[model samples]
Structures are given as C-alpha cells and as structure tokens.
Target: MALEINMNNFKEEVLEAKETVLADFWAPWCGPCRMQGPVLEKFAEANPDVKVVKINVDDNQELAMQFKIMSIPSMIVFKNGEAVNCAVGLQSKAALEELVK
Candidate 1:
C-alpha cells in the first residue's frame, strides 16, 4: 500500500529517502486519481524496493505548488532527492514501471 503523506513528513518520507520514491499527487474527488490509486497499489506490490506515496493536493497545497502540479494524478519519481521523471494524468502499471526505470 502507498503511504499517505503530508507536509510534516514530506522531506523525511520522500526527499530524504534512500530508495526511489514515487509520489502520487492527487485529490480524493478526482476521478482519474481514484482510477490511479489501485494501479499505484499494484505497482507498489510488484516493486517492493520502490517507495510509493500519495500526496493529497487538497491538503498539501504548498507541496503541490512547489512541484508545479497543474493537473490531477500527477506522478513524480524522485531519485537522490531530485525529481527524475514526471507524468501527468492516470497511468498504467507498465507506464509507472517505465517512469521509475
């Protein structure tokens, strides 16, 4: 399961993590976000080494603004505390795997 994150732990959980982190920026009301949730879970299950997290844009507006999240279901892959890849809109399990790779 993907951990739900907030500003309080954003740095510790994502930016400072040793493993590759997949941060899913989404809101509960977004249809696409809902669709993406299970895919993320599946991805997390398949790739145990990768860190998966969910950031609610409604709750973490500052984080969203910092990441320049203009759309729902935005997926950002972080490596070595830097954003290495980003994808907007809903993504498949295969696509998520590709992004992390």
Candidate 2:
C-alpha cells in the first residue's frame, strides 16, 4: 500500500528515505488521481526497494508548491531527495514502472 504522506511527515519519510521514493501528488476529488491509485498500489507491492507515498494537494499545499505540482495525478520519482522523473495525469502500470526505472 502507498503511504499517506502529509506535511508533518513529508521530510522524514520522503526526504530522508534511503531508497528511491515515489511520490504521488493527488486529491480526493480528482478523477485521474483516483484512477492512478490502483496502479500505485500494485507498484508498491512489486517493488520492495522503493518507498511509495501519496500526497494530497488539498492538505499539503506547501509540499505541492515546492514540487511545482500544478496538475493532479502527478507522479514523481525521487532519488537522493531530488526529483529525477515526473509525469502528470493518469498513467498505466507499464508507464509508471518505466518512470521509476
């Protein structure tokens, strides 16, 4: 399961993680975000080496602003606390997996 990340624990969980971190920025009302949820879940199950977390833009505006997330269903792959790859809107399992790779 993807961890539900909030402003309070974003630094500790994402910034300080030893492994590659995948952050999915989304909101409850966004249709694309909802659609991406299952893909993320399966990705988390398959990749034990990666840290997957979900950030709700409505609640964590500061983090969203810092990441420059102007769109919903944004997926970012982070290595060494820096964003290496990013994609906006809905993505298939293959595409999301490839983004991390």
Candidate 3:
C-alpha cells in the first residue's frame, strides 16, 4: 500500500526522503482517482526501492494548494528534494516506471 501523506507530514515523509518519491494527489469523489489507486498500490508494491505516497485532496487541502493541484489523480515525481516530473491524468504502470527511471 502507498503511504498516506498529508500537510502535517509532507515535510517529514516526502520532502526529506532520500530516494525517489512519487506522490499521487487524489480525492475520494473522483472516479479517476479511484481508478488510479490500485495502479499506485501495485506500482508501490513492485517498486520497493522507491517511495510512493498518496495525498487526499479533501484531507490535505493545504498541501494540494501548495502544489497547485487543480485536478485529481495528479502525480508528482520527486528526486533530491525537487520535483522533476509530473503527470496529470490516468497513466499506465509502464509510463510511471519510465518516469522513475
């Protein structure tokens, strides 16, 4: 399962992670967000070396606003404390793997 991230713990878990971090910004009411959940879970399970996180927009509104998340199911890939890439829609596991590489 992907780690649940929030505004209170964002700095500790994501911003400070040493490994590559992939964050999926989602909301419970979003259909696309629901579809992306299992993908992220599977991806996280397969890629143990990388950090996969899930941030619920409804719960973590502050963090969502900080990242300018205007849509659900947005993914932000971070490395060395900086956001290197972002995908703002439903994406295949292969595409996500490519981003990790």
Order candidates by lDDT, high to low: 1, 2, 3
* Local distance difference test, candidate 3: 0.89
lDDT of 3 by residue, 22-98 (tens): 99999889999899888887888889999999999999888889899998789999898888999899878888998
Candidate 1 structure lDDT: 0.97
TM-score attained by model 3: 0.94
TM-score of each: 0.99, 0.96, 0.94
Comparing 2 and 3 by TM-score, which wins? 2
Q: Candidate 2: which stretches are off by over 4 Å?
A: none
lDDT on C-alpha atoms for all candidate structures:
0.97, 0.92, 0.89
Error of 1 at 27 (Å): 0.3
Cα lDDT tens digits for candidate 1, 1-101: 89999999999999999999999999999999999999999999999999999999999999999999999999999999999999999999999999999
Cα RMSDs, all models: 0.4, 0.8, 0.9
Give the least accurate 10-residue stretch of model 3, judged by summed lDDT.
6-15
Among these predicted structures, which one has the highest TM-score?
Answer: 1
Best by lDDT: 1
